[model samples]
Target: MSNQEENINLPLVHKGKVRNVYDFNGNYLIVASDRISAFDWVIPTLIPNKGKVLHKLSMFWFDFVKDIVPNHIITGNFEEFPAELKKYEYLRDRSMIVKKANRVDIECIIRGYLAGSGWKEYQKSKTVCGIKLPDGLQESSKLPQPIFTPSSKEENGKHDENISFEETVKRTGKDTAEKLQELSISLYKKVADYALTKGIILADTKLEFGFYDGHLILIDEIFTPDSSRFWEVEKYAQGVSQDSLDKQYVRDYLEKIKWDKSSPAPELPKDIVEKTLEKYTDAYEKLTGRKF
Candidate 1:
């Protein structure tokens, strides 16, 4: 269901491209919708079971990394949710009760491999987010080391532009900026390593952090196909774009059709929607070792 169609009784707080946030008492109820977006547009079609895949994968990763950083999740367990929430059986496995936080307005991006906007930046200035890289890096070449590149977090329907670390310090305080970098890189390395063991390469991922109760904690989604680039290890090639277990498949289709970004987004074909859900479920199964 689309965010606009969600029928939760709580006061609507924010409706993102693929999720709806509702004010639940003083906390928040975050529901993952089946809506899929590409090129900053929320596609009109819904992918079946897409929301459950994102929510379940996030629940697994949140538990896996809780030792490194606390998250906004209060409980993913439906049984533990408030009695009022239990009435919405459709929310099962697709929603979470979370702490409301003062979210930091930076997209904490860690790139282990050169691709996407980072590659476009490297082709011209040999830098990403103003971080210089080694000479002669190909389109999808593995970087010598992962780097923390941050961007300004824009509101929904706007594009997020890459920013320099200095700009990050300017926007946030120096101490907060440094801590964000440290935590972002650490989290990326740990999860990337774990993904490698599962035969998937976590090319790059954007993380969101927020201040909750005077402590910085992870917020939003983590390592899910929507938030991260996942490539099959066996299919990876340096000089070309690798097949991804993410929405990149849908993005490629949109690009192939040459959909003018200014126009109303096109509805995805049935095969495309099915394949997209397959990719998301594939990532979830491979990373978490659970059938989807």
Candidate 2:
């Protein structure tokens, strides 16, 4: 076997939001760091164990719902991780060992509520990514059923644009497009239903999929606060926007800034950083029913 054939800690190919993807022989070792990003730019501060919490939460869902669908999780145990990462075992729950697959070029989005780009698209065109909604739907109103809205996975610093299903088929092949849509909606509904029962309203989420061999598998994080909009069940109601358990506070702060929302992201204030960390911790405890 070549040196690269044996599991070795190599260089990283991509870093996004809270995770770092490093080359580990033929497989990849994805390390979940405590880093956070808002408005598509990575912020300055770390959120103590945020990566581990996110990883643990996703692992819980993967196990809870794997019977419903297959995923790409190779291993989450530190003992099985590459030797170079053993010192970071304190964050074992956040990192994952996964086969590096050819990631689908589209971002598979599922929306159960009208907000974010969905809301903005609806307000202007009375539709979101080519899916028209019923008239008179208020902000944050729940849809009768979840919808699969695909977006472009742009290069760094570029915004992901919501594309029609036909457009998705154009970018990815027709067969792959059909599979992604089916799998995305299936997983979203299963995970969302479970979260609802656990007092967390999974308003909406984004999932990325990839092809490993001939199988369609779920890649990246599932329904973590960073990837999904989570709300407290007791406070959620139709028509009214409730406080999100995720990084809404951080987003709100960023919105108030004068930056152009581009590269070289602004440094978040200490107080804002602290509050954001607390929010992540609170969501970890609330959704997982355990302390971080």
Candidate 3:
């Protein structure tokens, strides 16, 4: 079924690049779509089964980290869904029912490697998010330790701007800011260590948090290819962009074509879409030890 047309009779709360959120009894139903985005633009083509891979991987990670932090998930199992939602069989493996929380407007980014915007920033100032790093670091070099770099989370069609730690403190106040840093680092360390055991490098990940009844809880997707950079340990290299099992492949393809960012995004070739789905599926299987 085409996710774009599968209207669930629920009140639409948000329609993001790759997910649609619905209001359900004071809660939210987040449906991961087959849609993919790169270079901040939503690609015209959809990757088959991409949404299921993301949903399942997120379920795995949420369960894995429940001991470390409370999350907004109420349930992801379709059979357990409220009776009213049962007719939408399409949501079975691609949707999650979660508590409604006041979303924190900051992107809680934890970088354990020199890559992406962090690498670009480091090349110029030897610092990422204003956190000075040791000199001589390469493109994909691992940092001495993970650092909490926060960003202002913008709405769809906008870019998230990285901010300093002090800026985070000013925005969130001292206590909430410190708590976000502590939880973000702890979550990264635990998951990165686990990913290494499965022969994948959890390069860096972006996290989101929200306030639930006056308490901070993890919200949004965690550790999925769309939210994290996953590289095969076998292909690890320094000073160069490592082959990644994530949407970085899509980003690379877009870069190679030299598509100017201002124009409407172009449709991806068949091969590109298939290969992109493969990378996401591979990450899901490798990390979850289950067939995608």
Worst 10 residues of 2 by lDDT: 1-10
Of candidates 2 and 1, the better by TM-score: 1
lDDT of each: 0.92, 0.79, 0.92
Candidate 2 is scored at a TM of 0.90
**Per-residue error (Å), model 3, residue 80:** 0.4
Which ten residues in a row are the worst by lDDT in model 3? Answer: 1-10
Candidate 3's residue-wise lDDT over 86-145, tens digit each? 888889899999999899899999999999999999999999989999999999999999
- Model 1, 128-160: lDDT tens per residue? 878899999999999999999998989957898
Could you tell me which residue pairs clash in candidate 3?
Answer: none
**Any runs in candidate 2 off by more than 4 Å, and if so which?**
1-9, 82-84, 88-91
For candidate 3, the per-residue lDDT at 5 reads 41
Better of 2 and 3 by lDDT: 3
Off by over 4 Å in 3: 1-6
C-alpha RMSD for every candidate = 1.3, 4.2, 1.2
- Pairs in clash, predicted candidate 1: none
RMSD of 1: 1.3
Q: How many steric clashes does model 2 contain?
A: 0
